[model samples]
Target: MRSFVVSVVSISLVASAVFAHSGVKNEDVMKRMKQMSEMASNMKVLGAMMKQQQPFDLPLAKAAISKIGELSAETGKSFATKAEDPKSEAKPIIWDEFDEFTKLADALTKDALQLQSSLKGPEDLRNVMATLGGACKQCHSKYRE
Candidate 1:
């Protein structure tokens, strides 16, 4: 009876260690990625509204831009905290090329801040949209699958 209990505890310890080393949960990473995707979708809609030169919905546009900034910050945190999680779509190159990733993230934050600041009118918003799009493209091309 004593030997059986010891064997069970030893197996449990090894299993826990293996699981811990493998990767993050797929669902958890997907949830984080989905939040980012939703933020991007909202930004796209705001851009289209600005391009159309419709009555600038200041509140809505501001909210969307704010969400983008929030999500970008969250993404930066996740990338830093869960650096080893293979389940995240974030490329391993993100860690391997840390300087480049940090530069792009900084650019993204800057573009988002600019978008928030320049939402004074439709034309200004459109111009900021272009910069925001460039930031997204830059990061996606380098760090995403």
Candidate 2:
């Protein structure tokens, strides 16, 4: 678990450095970008564990799921006002179809919460990914660039 946390922190640091050059000027947009980056890093960790590239630690897996759920809950609020930035991947249609966008965010939160509870072993993580990942892809395909 300690190593997992360290890995996530390292990824976040690197992502932050990269995002610094993404040219996002709006503070809110930058914050959103960072949030999304963090989610991606958590997903990467989950993927590594699922693939057996990294040893699966239950605590770390739970922690990652928890962070994703927390972030998913906030996703709607983050995009509530249609803040714009040059490097943001969010599509303008998000604001145009705000309800649908938020609904997808809500679905992600629900899926994550459900996944967190159902995980019993490494194999469970693989199953969880299919459902959780599908929710993410469903939203990103329509709402993100």
Candidate 3:
């Protein structure tokens, strides 16, 4: 679990650094990007705690999971508009297969809520993180370019 979190953070950091300063023009799309960034930041904290890189903070993990749940609940609405920004990685298939996208978003919301409710310790996060990552990949593979 520690290794997984490290890998995700390392990969995401490298990816973001490589593509820093996007040319996205739309405010709406930018908002979504910011939300995703925040989510990743939250995950990084949890990962750190889980890996013992930081002190175990149950409240922080709970809060992060809660925030994820809250944000995920609105994901469908957040992407409701067909706003286009060249900097956006979202693919056209998202609009074309809107139902499929929303379905995955809804599933994420549910999983986040479940994680928040059931989270007891780092071990729990370690187990649930895999599930969360899978949900993200499912949406990303189909909707994200």
Candidate 4:
């Protein structure tokens, strides 16, 4: 399990390094990416705990989920301006259907809150992560490039 966690984090780090070199020039786009990256980092920690790679710490789980909730709430505001960058993964349809895009982000925040409130152990974490991940996938499929 520990080896699996290390492999996952290693892959994420390598991918992040590659993306970092992709010449993302727009400040707003960079901010958006940074926010998303932070959320992903927190999720990775929770995921390791959920998978039993690491011992579950309720306080740490709460902190990570709380941060995700805060970031999810800010998603709409981050993308509200329709900033562009060659490296941006956001699709043009986001601005075209801003309401729908933001609705998804809002739903993510709600999911995070639900997760935070209901999280008691690894089992609950697993369920909540699935819901949160589904929310993310739904938005990405529609609004991300």
RMSD of each: 15.7, 2.7, 5.2, 3.3
Cα displacement (angstroms), candidate 4, residue 138, comes to 0.7
Regarding lDDT, does 2 or 4 come out ahead? 4
Query: Whole-model lDDT, candidate 1?
Result: 0.68
- Segments in model 4 whose C-alpha atoms lie over 4 Å from true places: 1-22
Model 1 vs. true fold: TM: 0.68
Q: Write the per-residue lDDT of candidate 2 for residues 19-113, one digit (tens) a residue.
A: 56477789899888778777877887798889987888898898898899999899988888789877778889898889998898898898888
User: What is the TM-score (0 to 1) of candidate 3?
Assistant: 0.83
Q: Which pairs of residues collide in model 4?
A: none
lDDT, candidate 3, 8-120, per-residue tens: 87788758844653777898888788777766767777777778887677887889887877787788888999888878898988888888888998998899888888888
lDDT of 3: 0.79
**Candidate order by decreasing TM-score:** 2, 4, 3, 1
Candidate 4: TM-score? 0.86
Query: Which pairs, if any, clash in model 1?
Result: none
Model 1: residue 86 alpha-carbon error in angstroms: 7.9
Q: lDDT (CA) for every model shown?
A: 0.68, 0.84, 0.79, 0.84
What is candidate 4's lDDT per residue for 28-109, written digit by digit as tens? 9988888888777778778888888778889889888888889989999999898999888999989998999889889889
